[model samples]
Target: MRSSLMRSLHAAGLIDYYALLIHPLTLGSGARLFEGPAPLAEFELTGSVTTSKGVIIAYYARH
Candidate 1:
């Protein structure tokens, strides 16, 4: 992430200000209803929290 930010800064030329976006990943599990199935973790992905910054504001969101 730092590398990417650095590259972008360099490309933009003297980036004194920057907007950053962060994301949080959440996963859920379901109890095994059948024995012939894979683990619940692999079966489903639960919630995803994402962050996006605009102008000068940063926030997180679920997508």
Candidate 2:
């Protein structure tokens, strides 16, 4: 799934930028984006967008 792909990319040091679509809902419990122990990496929020459905698409670039 998407988490696997993201984890792979992160492990391989291939994630330079991220575009995450955040839906406007909480399921009470779910998977974490950066799960478990990981090296500290900094990212700067470059931009974002709020869709008509209240979904937020956030853009970030590794710093």
Candidate 3:
């Protein structure tokens, strides 16, 4: 459901930018940000930052 809505919004050019914060730790398994069986979307890297504790913050914009 969420993936379908995201795909629709991106397809209609409604999404201009998005950001993701990646942590150093990891779980054995978990849900991903993007889901569903659709082809992967394209995005441009705008900026990024690495915290003192090693967390990574990434910014992205529509291509």
Candidate 4:
């Protein structure tokens, strides 16, 4: 599963940069990213952008 893989990557300290895109619509319910029991990882905002349609693209790097 993707969640498991992400968790493993987090545990191994292999993630340097993580980016996520947020749309204007909400799903109400669906798979959530970054869901796990591990401690919260600190990330610094590297960059971000918004499209004409209102979609936000965010970029983050581990701190």
Candidate 5:
């Protein structure tokens, strides 16, 4: 989803000056959640598997 800050920046033609802050990704094998008015749907994404203790145990895709 687009953030309000991004919209404001774009309106002022300052897109070059704005950047989305990135954070380190958590390693895990779980479904990502996206909620809307309707039912949630699962999309294909790539990542790593994680255990109960937050340890990365395997690849998201077996192949």
Candidate 6:
């Protein structure tokens, strides 16, 4: 999903959890997942796993 839409949904309290896949690579710079100014929110890491290919599947619950 687009960052804008995600931000909107989060701001409206429509999001309960987040499942993110993190790759073990990075370029010099790129677009961020959460862009621009947004309401402050907290999340707790509920679970996570690492794939054989070094990908991290992380789960977080909103607080």
The TM-score values for the models, in the order shown, are 0.24, 0.84, 0.70, 0.79, 0.23, 0.87
Number of the top TM-score candidate: 6
Which stretches in model 2 have alpha-carbon errors above 4 Å?
A: none
Which residue runs of candidate 3 sit more than 4 Å off their true CA positions? Answer: 1-8
Q: Which lDDT tens digits does candidate 3 get at residues 10-62?
A: 66768888877788887898776656554556789999999999999999997
lDDT of each: 0.38, 0.87, 0.78, 0.84, 0.38, 0.88
Write candidate 4's Cα lDDT for 1-63 as tens digits.
387897789878888888888888977987767675676788899999999999999999999
Which residues of candidate 1, in runs, are more than 4 Å off? 1-8, 11-13, 26-63
Order of quality (TM-score): 6, 2, 4, 3, 1, 5
Candidate 1 per-residue C-alpha lDDT over 1-63 given as tens digits, one digit per residue, 9 for 90 to 100: 465555554455544333443334335754332335322221222333343622323432222
Query: How well is each residue in 1-63 modelled by candidate 5, as lDDT tens digits?
Result: 345554554455444322223234666753322232323223232444555655554322211
RMSD of 1: 17.3
Total clashes in model 6, counting residue pairs 3 or more apart in sequence or in different chains: 0
TM-score of 4: 0.79
Error of 3 at 34 (Å): 1.7
Q: Candidate 6, clashing residue pairs?
A: none
Residue-level lDDT for 46 in candidate 5? 49
The alpha-carbon deviation from the true structure for residue 15 of candidate 5, after best TM-score superposition, in angstroms, is 0.8
Cα-based lDDT at residue 34, candidate 4:
60
Q: Pick the candidate with the highest lDDT.
A: 6
